[model samples]
Target: MAIPPDIKDSIAKVKPLSQSAVRLMSIMADPDHTVAQIAAVVESDPILTGNVLRVVNSPAFGLRAKISTVARAVSYTGGNMVVGLALHLCASGIFNNPLDGYESQRGSLWRHCLFTAIASREIARFSDGKADPEVAYTAGLLHDIGKAVMSAPLGDSARKIIAIADKGEMPDFVAGEAKAVGTDHPEVGEAIAIHWSLPGPLREVIRHHHAPSKAKEEYRTLVYAVHLGDFIAMMSGTGTGADTMLYLLDHDYRNFVDISAAELEKVILDAGQEYQQVVESMFGSEEEMQ
Candidate 1:
């Protein structure tokens, strides 16, 4: 299926992640990067700096001593959390807006992404350290970004795509999208990731999350981690729209992640609780989220 040219243009027009945010992500992806290095990037952007302090000091962390410096916040919260704050501050427009093609309300996609991030982090814990939980969290946060690009182009056909999935005519909503619209969110997400110059792991995870088995061998574990995370988000009622649980699960995830049924349930519950706190910290208040 060929992606429409207009969608290509839309992908190009999508705002690039801030320079500081990009730098932070790059630094965070390297496990050996120091806290001071990450803090230096966050401190370079005042908005990111304030958000780091705010998130670290938020009730989510329950730190009695207020974090007064970016260095301290980075040290306390870790590079993944600091990078997430930077991305949230810079990409709120992309995250907060409604995906009309999906018939999702404003802010629902962001909530879904946030929930997936937490779930992905938890799920990666079961990966025997083959996959980095921190990277999994960031990948989950941005996994469906292609949906934002595909949304408008898909338009009213989204209903048709949903129908295709519901009637079992397609294997999943992504397949429905391909049959109905000639492309799917994950494909579009790959374009956006490339457009944004996102890290290789992120680009691959965003692209292959729905079909983890199709990912390259080295990346399959991380992709499967995010795939499960995305599923848990939708199952927990934080899906972006009608396509929520319509996607097929790659049961082979057990081979990659080693999460037992009971452990999966615990992850869902714990991640759900963490998601609420993270959302509040990132967005300030429920009112602001809307």
Candidate 2:
């Protein structure tokens, strides 16, 4: 679907990710970027380096030993995980705002995004071969970027959409956004990703997460992972928005990831534990981030 010019303009006004995040993302985009290169970029910023070590030692990675150095963290968790940790830390400022349109309190969306990203990583790890953990993490982290854009400058419009959504007039947040703005957040997010020249698969996941079957076949697995992760985050009450329980869980999610109900239960349980630690790694505590 083509993005409306109005939505494109709205997305343009949404702030770009921080330069440090962009640099880490650029390095991660290169398949050949070495762990040393990733560690070097992360180490350039003391905060990012600390966050990387925090994440590596956190229960999120299930590491038996604490990592004290960026190089060691990268070696322990892979370059992609290290880069993702850096991006999350550097980009926290951007996600810390309240999403008025989505009814997300200050830092709520950030918590949701963090949980979803971690859930996506776990889903990929258990996919048996359908997805990449690192790629899934990035996709899940950014799947709702357009929602932020839509919520930033379109508060009144979003209120109207949300009212309609509350009445069951729309299928989900994406549908309500399209009804109010002539384009949904996913489309606007796709445009924003294109504007930023983000990787193609990342753009696809952001665009088609609401409809993974409609995405390019190459990215369908990744999209499915993010979609399920998003659902899991909402269901787990991981600091989500008013749209919580508004979206439908794909009944056939098992077809994509081959995870049983029992396994998925474990994922949600583990994600809740990691979510607290991940949030602490980036923002200290819920009170502080807010």
RMSD of each: 1.6, 3.4
Candidate 2: list runs displaced more than 4 Å: 1-6, 14-20, 26-34, 45-47, 50-68, 73-81, 89-93, 157-163
- Model 2: per-residue Cα lDDT over 1-290, one tens digit each: 56677667766765566666777777765556788887887788877777677767766567777778888887876765565565556555446678887777877776777788889889877777768777788777778777766775456665676678789877887777776666777887788788767888889989988788888987788888998998889888774576677676666667778887798899999988877765665456778667
Q: Give, for candidate 2, the lowest lDDT window spanning 10 residues.
A: 85-94
Q: Look at candidate 2 and tell me the lDDT of residue 190.
A: 87
Query: Compared with the true structure, what per-residue lDDT tens digits does model 1 show for residues 1-290?
Result: 56788788888899989999889777767767788898888878888888788788887688888889888888887777776777777887788888888999998878888889889989999999888887898899899998887888778887887777677777888887887677899999999999998988999999999999999888889999999999999999999987888889989999999888999999999988877776677666656776
| Local distance difference test, candidate 1 | 0.85
Worst 10 residues of 1 by lDDT: 278-287
* Cα shift from native, residue 173, model 2 (Å): 2.0
Flag regions of model 1 displaced more than 4 Å: 59-61
lDDT, candidate 1, residue 71? 83
In TM-score terms, candidate 2 sits at: 0.84
